[model samples]
Target: MEREKVIEVRDLVKKFGAFTANDHLSFDVYRGEIFGFLGANGAGKTTAIRILCGLSRPTSGRVMVAGIDASRRPEEIKKRIGYMSQRFSLYEDLTVRENIELYGGIYGMRMKELIHRREAMLQRLSFTSYGDTLIRSLPLGLRQKLSFATAVFHDPEIVFLDEPTSGVDPVTRRQFWEMIYETASQGITVFVTTHYMDEAEYCDRITIMNEGKIVALDTPSVLRQQYGTATVEELFVKITRPQRTMV
Candidate 1:
């Protein structure tokens, strides 16, 4: 079966004065995909992501996210997607339920529907007892899970996770990926950026960026085989840091 394209980019470019952050990039993200956007520091993947999220405008070329023209209608694009940053973008002083209500409102969900979904989400997270607990009181892993849940409160067509599992314990990270898989199984496109190579392997397909351009893009297993590397970590190092790779 032919997959539907949810995001389409062609010759996308974003420049900052004398420097170019994204350089003529082009890629397609399909519906229900777990697309990994990988890169080392200063690779311009962040810039590209911001553009795709409609948080920033691309300098040139076509960029469509969820069928909206990201460059021309950034605000409209925002309504169609969800974003969870590494910081877990939650109110430290707010109780878990309050924070969920806040984000649900921001996503334009109806009050009654928000309350219903919020309760269901808490139940699913095994967080029924933590509704009144302040976000600051919860552990990092729990807070991260809440952030993911709130980000998708409106059930967006796509979700952008920027290092969503960073700095968590291995078990917590595994649990987080399970949520990601469940989200994708429901046909929501998961666009994640992670530095952990093991997490990269969990993605259905990944595109590696270097120096503002894509250097490698494929399934983790295919990338490993094509690069003659046993692991995605080795493949990442080989592509992004050739100087550290030995012949």
Candidate 2:
């Protein structure tokens, strides 16, 4: 069966003066798949994501996200996707309910629908009592969870998560991935970037980038078999070792 592609990038390139961040990149992300975008620092992962999310325009090549041309319809693309950055974006001065309402309103969600969805999310996270709690008062793990829930509040077709579980404990990270799985099951494409190889394994498919190019892209099992490696971490180290050595 042919899966529907929700993101298509062909010969994509992004250059800042003399430096090329994404060099002739091309890929397709299927509908409802948990797609992992993996790369070492300075590998252009963030640049490419920014372009796809309509925060930045690609220098050249075709990029389509959620059926909108990213280069031409950047604002429209923004409406169809959600983004949760590495640093938490929730306002510490606001209560959980206030943060949710703020983002929901920004996404153009109505008051009635926003309230219904917000309550459901709070209940699902066992956070009904914390609705009025200021974000500054919550723990890091709890804050990260709320950030994710808020990002997807308006039912975007795709959500981009950059190091979504960076500083949390192992147990909290595990719980975070469960939420990711639940989101994918609901047919929301999960586009995540993580340094954790274990979390990479949780992705349905992964694309590894190095030196402004994709060095590997495949399912975890297939990528392991191709590299004759026992784990994704081993394969990642093997593939990116040369770049690490050069630096």
Candidate 3:
């Protein structure tokens, strides 16, 4: 079966004063795929994502997210997408159930549906009793897990995750990816940006950004074979770094 294209960027560009942030970016993200967007600091990944998420305007080019033209209907696009970042975005004073209720309310879920989702999420995260615990009392990993659950409570078609696992332990990171896989399995397209090279392999397809432009875009396995590198990390280095000259 052919999957639908949920996002399309054609020659997208963004600038800050005189400095360009995203330079003629173009790509199509299919539904139900974990699309990894990789870049170092200042590589312009966030700038392009901001434009896609309708939080920032691009200087030029066409960009569509979730089948809506971002430049033309940013508000509609925003309504159908979810966003979570390293900051977690949870209200510290709110408990787990409260946090879910808050975002579910914003998404306009009904009272009955909201309760159902809250219960399901609490059970999934093993937070049945912790539902009443304040968000501030949770550890970073638990906070991030709740953040992920909250972001998807309304079941957005595309969820933009910006370094969602920045400082978590290895086990927590692994568990987070399992949640991402479960999301994708439900036909949600997950857009992830990360500094962790190994995590990129978990994505179905990856686009590597360097110096405000995409230097590589393909499956992790294909990129490894194409670059003759053994790992995603090595392929990334080959794409971003200057090749050594044979002596």
Candidate 4:
């Protein structure tokens, strides 16, 4: 069977006054795949992400997430998708369980179901002992994992993660990618952005951007071969950085 398109973007653009953050961007994210979005700071990745997640409006273009119109049906789209921002969003004062319950409430989960899920999640995450621990008390890595678990607890069709592994240790970053892979295997589309070129290689396919336009899109292996580079890092430098030419 053919893979399903969970996110569709065509001629997408986002502008702030005279600045165009996303200039005629276009791409599609398929179901059950990890789609990496990469760009330097202020390269329009965040603007486009906000538009796709329904947090911001697009200046012009067709955008859809999980089959709902992103422009006309943002609320509906929100209900069907999960989001984890670069800034961890859980309440710092709330305990591990309380944070889960709070998000569960936001997702409109029933009390009984939430209770059941709470225990299951804690056990699955090996967080049972930290049920009463405040989010501020948890390690950054643990907090990152818990944030992801809460985002997907409501069984969203897709999950948007913006720079999920920034500031994390190498081991923790690997663990986090394992979770992303597991989520994809379960048929959930994963859309993520990061600065680490190594992490970019973890994505099944990636879209590299510069100045609000997609510079390249392909699997890591293909990109490397097409660019005749040894690594995604080299490929990124090749695309986004200026090259010195003989005069």
Tens digits of per-residue lDDT for model 1, 1-247? 8889999999999999989889889999999999999999888877888899998999999999999999899999999899997566799999999999998898878999999999999999999999999999999999999899888888999999998988899999999999999999999999999999999999999999999998988899999999999989999999988987876
The 0-to-1 C-alpha lDDT of every candidate, in the order given, reads 0.92, 0.94, 0.91, 0.92
Query: Which residues of candidate 1, in runs, are more than 4 Å off?
Result: none
lDDT for position 69 in model 1: 97
Tens digit per residue, CA lDDT, model 3, 75-110: 998889999965668999988888889889988899
lDDT of prediction 1: 0.92
User: What TM-score number comes out for model 2?
Assistant: 0.97
Candidate 4: where is the Cα deviation over 4 Å?
Answer: 244-247
Measure candidate 2: CA RMSD: 1.9
Best by lDDT: 2
TM for every model, in the order presented, reads: 0.97, 0.97, 0.97, 0.97
Q: How many residue pairs clash in model 1?
A: 0
Q: Put down candidate 2 lDDT per residue, 1-247, tens digits, no spaces.
A: 8999999999999999999999999999999999999999999999999999999999999999999999999999989999999888999999999999999999888999989999999999999999999999999999999999988988999999988998899999999999999999999999999999989999999999999999999999999999888999988998998566343
lDDT score for residue 189 of model 4: 89
User: How many backbone collisions does model 2 have?
Assistant: 0
Candidate 2's error at 128, in angstroms?
A: 0.9
Given candidate 1, what's the lDDT at residue 140? 95
Evaluate residue 3 in candidate 1 and report its C-alpha lDDT on the 0 to 100 scale: 89
